[model samples]
Target: MFQSDFLRKFRILLVLVRRDYALQYAGSALGLTWMFLQNLSLVLIYTIVFYFLGIRTQGEDPLAYFAYVLSGLLFWVPLQEYLIRGTGILTDNRQLIKRSPLGPEIFLWIPFIQFLLHWAITAVPILAFLLWAGKLGGIGLPISFLCVFCTGLFVACLQSYLARINIILRDISPLVRLMTQFLFWGLPILYESKGILGKLNLLNPLFYPLETFRSFLLSGYESKAAFTDFLPFLILFLAIFFLSRARLNQIVLDHL
Candidate 1:
């Protein structure tokens, strides 16, 4: 019974994701093709500036640098979707939430569902490039995806807390956007990783997964240090998730 119920909801989730995707591109001329083109264009801009203008990170190899930037985008794009768009999930769907049989907490999964879609879209070219460059190892790709899944769990909890706060504060949306911008720039993608910012990655949780992704993509390997980083980050993520969850009562959520 439980398995059937879960499958039924999962089916509904897929339908909503399709509807949302269609609605987003409703008025566009190219429609779905723009999704592919948009990412390609963004990749080109970064590649041209950093790879062509004599600026480089990770290495001087064109393929490696491009792969490096693309790898960073893999983690960053979904995160932007999770935090920036997810911050507004409750407020934006308040009407549906109030009327729907399902609770608002069910809607929190929308951002995460979208994250999986966005991550897949971004992963294609990275996989292609790594394969073309002769860098993709069997385990590396799967492990990288596992890292993404692990980190994404925290995004849900963080989004839930932030969305709740946004209901009362109203400024969290913009604050989240602004802070996300800072977080991207602070990442070592644009600048070389040996700088002060790279050393400061111990505090930046995403850095662990990003670095792990890059390492596996580049060297086809992961280190013990990668495992070490994930342990502490996992602990921190679990603490935040439990603490935030305690506040997400159904009564308060419905009232909000």
Candidate 2:
């Protein structure tokens, strides 16, 4: 019974994913090209600033520094977009949720899959640049890539859970934006994690995943230390997933 239900919902998720992709760029002058344009502009601006400020990594080469920052930006951008958009998935689609036969969980998956598609599209240029610039060393590509995937999944599930609660209390929506802004600085996206890990920086879970990603991609070195750091995040994600699933129906019904 559960398997049939899961498949039905998964099919609905795929349909919603298609709908979101179309709606996002439908009728725009530039269409889907805007995705690339936006990312390119942001990359150029950040690259220039970091270059002028002599923000190169300590042990990694200059090209590697660019690759590091770019990779993190790639993942971070999608994660942020998903969180922001997913926060309103239920509220914005309240009518559909109330009237359609589609499960609420399907609506929750739509933004995540849409953001994942965007992430994949954005990664093409980044990977090409890394290869051309010879910044990618084979040290921890697989592990780092896995970590990136995990981060995306973890963020998606976390956002879905948060969105449900946010609907119950509208105040959480703004609070989420505020928290994400603070976290952007707290994470070691532009700087080395070693410089700020010992103090209050430990409070942000984003730090470890960002650092682990950069360590493997930019430095071409794999320290067991990096993987060790992600253990806590893994546990936290699992706990949240189970707890959220347990109350999933109740939350949806209450909001409706």
Candidate 3:
């Protein structure tokens, strides 16, 4: 039933994913080169800005700050893109949804596939830097690599539900932006969660997964809290998805 309902459109979905991915960089001379440079600029900007302030990532290590920021981006960038793009999937593709027989859920998956592609491409430099620094092996590469996509999938599912809800409440778009701004500062992406941020980290859903990636990839810090603390949120989203999915599909196309 699940396959029939969702996976039936797999081929069409892949075509859409490919089209969108290509269109994303369309008209740009450098194309994906610009994307790599953008990622590198982010690392360089943070590294230089923080150096002046004497902000040590975990210790006196030099590349620790770069690795810390890069690992956090591995999760946050994809999740943020999912949140912002997925929220508007229905509205953005209203005409396409109107014409296609596929469910609105398929539209949600497009940005996800895009996220995965972007992450994999952008990560090449970070991986090379880590390999050069000899911190690559300490990262639990295979497991952490798996976690990255799984995290993308988990966030995608949750955001798909949000995409539907945003259709009903148009104000949700701005609210999501505001909330993510709060979350961006709240999550220890550019900095470690210490003192106030550490205590308040429990309130932000993105914290655990972001921290889990950072812990393994950057600091060799391992904790079961990623599972224990983060599982409930995932389960809650799955529950919401299951409960509302059918109704959403039935109304979404017509409403859009």
Candidate 4:
């Protein structure tokens, strides 16, 4: 049954992904090129301002800061995309959920897979940038790839659980958007974790995955250390995933 459900969900996800990819370039003059342009512009603006302000590390190379910031941004984009799309998934497909034979939970996977596809596509430029900056060496490659995959899984689960909750409580959706907006600054994306934690002691759990990811990828830090640091997050992610799956059907039925 699980296998059958998985195959069904995979087919639905593929259709959604195709639609999303088309929609992304439907009316755009530059088509899919806009994706690279958007990311490049943001990276350039961030690198220039941070460099001038001397916000980067003194000991590290100049490009190190750019690599660090880019790594975090890469991890962040899929996470943000899932959150934004997942929250609205149910409402947007209320007709299908109410009438179709497919499980509502399948809809949750749509946004998750869509974000994963976008993340894979975005990785091309990120790889080029890393190679150009001469940081793509040794342990960085494997650890960074692993960290990205793990972090993506965690975010997918987090967004799926949150989507169920948001459908029941409409206000929760906007609150999530506000929280993610605040988190862009609060999560140490553009700055070093040490500096952020030094200023604020009680760090949120949501930020740890990205911190661990950046450390492994840009800082060439040990994966075991980063994984151990986020053990609590892994535990929390599992608990949420199981609990959400267990109750998702009932939750969707009740909301309907």
- Highest-TM-score candidate: 1
For candidate 3, what is the total of clashing residue pairs?
A: 0
| Candidate 4 residue 7 C-alpha distance from true site, Å | 4.1
Error of 2 at 58 (Å): 8.7
TM-score versus the correct structure, for each prediction: 0.86, 0.82, 0.84, 0.80
**Model 2 agreement with the true structure over 1-256: per-residue lDDT tens digits:** 9999888778878987777666778899997789788977877787776644546656566666676678778768877777788888788777778898765777888887777677777767776777777776566456656767777777876887787887777537787888788877776567655654544456677766766676666545443234456578778877887788797768666777
User: Which segments of candidate 2 are over 4 A away from where they belong?
Assistant: 1-9, 52-61, 139-145, 197-201, 223-229
Root-mean-square deviation of each candidate, in angstroms?
2.7, 3.2, 3.2, 3.4
For model 1, residues 116-227, the per-residue Cα lDDT tens digits are 7778887887678768877676666787777788678856766777877776665588799998887787676665566576667656666776776667655543432356
Q: Candidate 4 lDDT, tens digit per residue, 156-226?
A: 66777787877787637778888778767766667665654634412455566666666666646432224
lDDT against the true structure, each candidate: 0.71, 0.72, 0.71, 0.70
Report the lDDT of model 2 for residue 12: 77
For model 1, the run of ten residues with the poorest summed lDDT: 217-226
Residue 254 accuracy (lDDT) in model 4:
77
True lDDT of residue 192, candidate 3: 69
